[model samples]
Target: MMRILLLAVLLLTVACGTVTPPIDIAPDAWISYDHKTSYFVSDAGADSVRLTVKYASFTFLDKSAELLPVAKSVFQRISNELAEKRGTVRAVYDSSKFYESVAYNGVSGVSTALVSNELTFSAKADSSGTPTSAIEPVEIVQKLEALKKALDSGLITKEEYERKKKEILERY
Candidate 1:
């Protein structure tokens, strides 16, 4: 009886203490391979994050409405953190899992991706909104073109690429 009680307490403690770490990243570059994304974050930030929600056969699903919340959460965290540090979050890269409502065992959701312009504004732009130290409109066009290529190659879904492309253009 005593052993059972001790084990129960230990299990409860572990479950309660399982805090998911915040996604801390300010990447110079990255590749969002559908779900398993690899970042080029500096030494100060992790260079990768992975989700096991999908695997071999389940990989490369389309982004559904259910997954939008996960994506939004990721963007919000990074944007807020960067803002607090007096910097701009030019982009946020992440893949999220959305669980289904009817879980017989433990399950649920969809997929989406965002390829961001990792360029931040220079401290000195000299009146022009363009970042003096960053790429201009031409670069944005290049990024859009590259995104299209990714879509063509099936690296990213149509919705994911289109959404990312729109975000970049709107911000420019």
Candidate 2:
């Protein structure tokens, strides 16, 4: 009886004393698509983020419900931006079996491209040991501009340029 009581108290103490570290949200550079769609990226507390995106189609023509060519262009531009980021999506699988969702599982990291699609943005760490992104918005724009110029100059073929550009934009 005494052992059982002691075990209960110990379990209670352990459960009650558990602590969750604080998170930080900061801006990161090298994480760009276009000014119009950049707002979709947001830091989830400090450790993670929620990346929601909508892509565009340049080849698609205007339809009855479709707003206009201008809208289609905008959608295509946004889609291009989103695709740029998607290239870095590494293959990751959950390790935990049953209770994996309840525990903090470490990330598996991102994949590497053969020619490299987008630039790397370093993660920011705060005093409390929280990691966040430190990429700037303007830097992303400049990179996009450079990419666009390279494509326009024929340095990169239309297909290759469009593909790579799309990958950069997809990074949510």
Predicted structure with the largest TM-score when compared to the true one? 1
lDDT of 1 at 86: 42
| Lowest lDDT 10-residue stretch of candidate 1 | 100-109
User: How badly does each model clash, as a count of residue pairs?
Assistant: 3, 24
Model 1: residue 90 alpha-carbon error in angstroms? 2.5
- Location of the lowest summed lDDT over 10 successive residues in candidate 2: 97-106
The local lDDT score (0 to 100) that residue 90 gets in candidate 2 is 26
| Candidate 1, 1-172: lDDT as tens digits | 9999999887665433211212433343343334533322232234222221211111233233344344345544554444335443232333223222111111222233332223232233335444444544556877999999999999999899979998888766
Q: Which stretches of candidate 2 lie over 4 Å from their true place?
A: 1-131
After superposition, the stretches of candidate 1 with alpha carbons farther than 4 Å from their true spots are: 20-74, 77-126, 133-172
User: Which tens-of-lDDT digit does each residue in 139-167 have in candidate 2?
Assistant: 45666899889998989988887887776
lDDT for 35 in candidate 2 is 41
